[model samples]
Target: LPATLFSATVQTPWAGIVAQSPLVLVLTGAMWITYAAIYFLATSVFKRTPQDAAVLSLTVALPNYAALGLPILGSVLGEGASTSLSVAVSIACGSVLMTPFCLLILEREKARAAGENSGSTLAMLPVLMWRSVKKPIVWGPLLGVVLSAIGIKMPDLLLASIKPLGLAATAAALLNT
Candidate 1:
């Protein structure tokens, strides 16, 4: 499956999609995660009667921040703001890809137990897009890139503020890890 996508990307040769805006990549990831989470919540978390599912979900999901993410960022982005942003974006994307699938399996087990067929989407779609649009962090990177690309550098102070907050979040994650 991954190979196929890689091949398609190669064939396309127009996928200038090299992490244009950290926000777009981040949002796409988050959108994926929430979609997965809601799927699990509706199908597994809500339906399942097992406490172990929570533990299983935790065990199967969250990655080691200080370990895997740091090395990847260091290797790819080096030790700088760009590295920090890249690592943060990559970690965010990777989690969205993996966590939801695990939760889906968990949810499917739950839906089965609850005697339900596949989950329903009657009340899910609109709200999901709304949530996606409302998220600023997800759009921030994209917006920043767009604004920058158009010869607009936000005030230095604002950029400075964003950087510190980003670093703080990363440090906090490392501590939690």
Candidate 2:
């Protein structure tokens, strides 16, 4: 997964991302809105517990974009299209932001279920945020992005070695999904 994220980050065109920032924002916004709506409905209408509602909302809102979205998008957009850039950007946003938000909710719910006083939300915010950011899923792409932004290039031999592993990881992810 880290290898895949590194490749995707390095390969993605930063210029195209900046050019299509507006569309990327729209896509990210839509995803968050969908998550919020589903969570609200699940909690209020269905009378589900917070933990259950969060899980349902996350499952519905965040599809396997890497496995499904990229292929379909590449086909329709003829590959390397700006629209694909938008999807990539939105995926990054969801990974960095929405994921932590969901984790925070779920953790709080878990604590509540265990009858432990997890303290106020604001008090726990920073620790949860830090924990979430430390996850490989969050940090791996971020590291890639940071390296790419600074124009660092891995040796051809090293990248070659990693590419197959990345591809295999992609397949593994799809299989898991």
Candidate 3:
């Protein structure tokens, strides 16, 4: 199936899925937030340093959703639009939101540890966020999303060119795990 059709089918079922139970969204959000909070509190209590707590919280909260979750979902559920959407949602949340949020926390903690003025950490947040946004992990999927939303079709040749790299990345991640 074409990428466009795959996306459309994924989106079609997603509305129904969401309509059937709004609780999924609520639960997902609450779960991630709770995980972050728990890790932050636990690490802070044990480490007794804001920087260490922030770093540990990130590791504890964020999982390798793309590499691991996608493969497991694919194997158990079989290939389908829902699986694709699930993978996309997991990747987007992990990369765009969680990674940047953790980075921000880490930066703030580091600043505090360095004895920077409190105001300076606040001042530095936008810069740190911009840096996070610019990172390839965040930017690549974001660009793909924007382009797809605008109905821009990627060239077949370009897609063909990147297929190997994507496969290689998945393989590398699996091997590392």
Candidate 4:
């Protein structure tokens, strides 16, 4: 899937089609935040610890979009429907936006439990966020977007080598269900 994402974002001229609107990205991020908030609040009524609430909320908030949504959407909607692009955007938004928020919640919970000042952790959030975004899951698609924007073409041999991995990802996803 990463290989296909790299190929599509770099080799194809579909950036405009993939990233049609900022609204989609905004809505995706908002949905995750709303879901997490709601889940956390709802779970709080159960008398669980902050960390437990954070974990429960995270499980409810993060969708299995890559492993489930992408394959189903590609098969059901067809590639021309821009499902791949939507999936890519969804992935990017989830990684960049949802992950940090969840981390913050978890970190706060930990600090509270340890009787430490969470203000220090909050102050370091930007650095922590930068580190989080450097993760391959986040940076891989980000790199693809940058390459696509610059009109850089992936090497044919590299594409050929990674094509199997993409195919295998799709196959494995389908078979797992």
On a 0 to 1 TM-score scale, where does candidate 1 land against the true structure?
A: 0.41
lDDT of 2 by residue, 64-133 (tens): 6655566668788777756556556666666656776787787676666777646887877876677667
C-alpha-based local distance difference test score of model 2: 0.71
Between prediction 3 and prediction 4, the one with superior TM-score is 3
Query: What does each candidate score in C-alpha RMSD?
Result: 10.8, 2.8, 5.2, 4.0
The most accurate candidate by lDDT is 2
RMSD of 1: 10.8
Q: Kindly indicate the candidate among 1 and 4 with the higher lDDT.
A: 4
Over 6-115, each residue of candidate 3 has an lDDT whose tens digit, in order, gives 23222333343344344446545854786668666766656546556665666666676656766688889998877766666655555556666766766666667677
lDDT of each: 0.44, 0.71, 0.60, 0.64
**lDDT of prediction 4:** 0.64
Residue lDDT tens for model 4, 51-134: 677666755776656567667788799866467676766655555456556666665656567676547766757755665565
For model 4, state the Cα shift of residue 58 in Å.
Answer: 3.8
Lowest-sum lDDT 10-residue window in model 1: 4-13
Which candidate number has the best TM-score?
Answer: 2
Candidate 3, residue 135: the lDDT equals 61
Q: Please identify which of the two predictions, 3 or 4, would achieve the higher lDDT against the true structure.
A: 4
Cα RMSD of predicted structure 2: 2.8
Candidates sorted on TM-score, descending: 2, 3, 4, 1
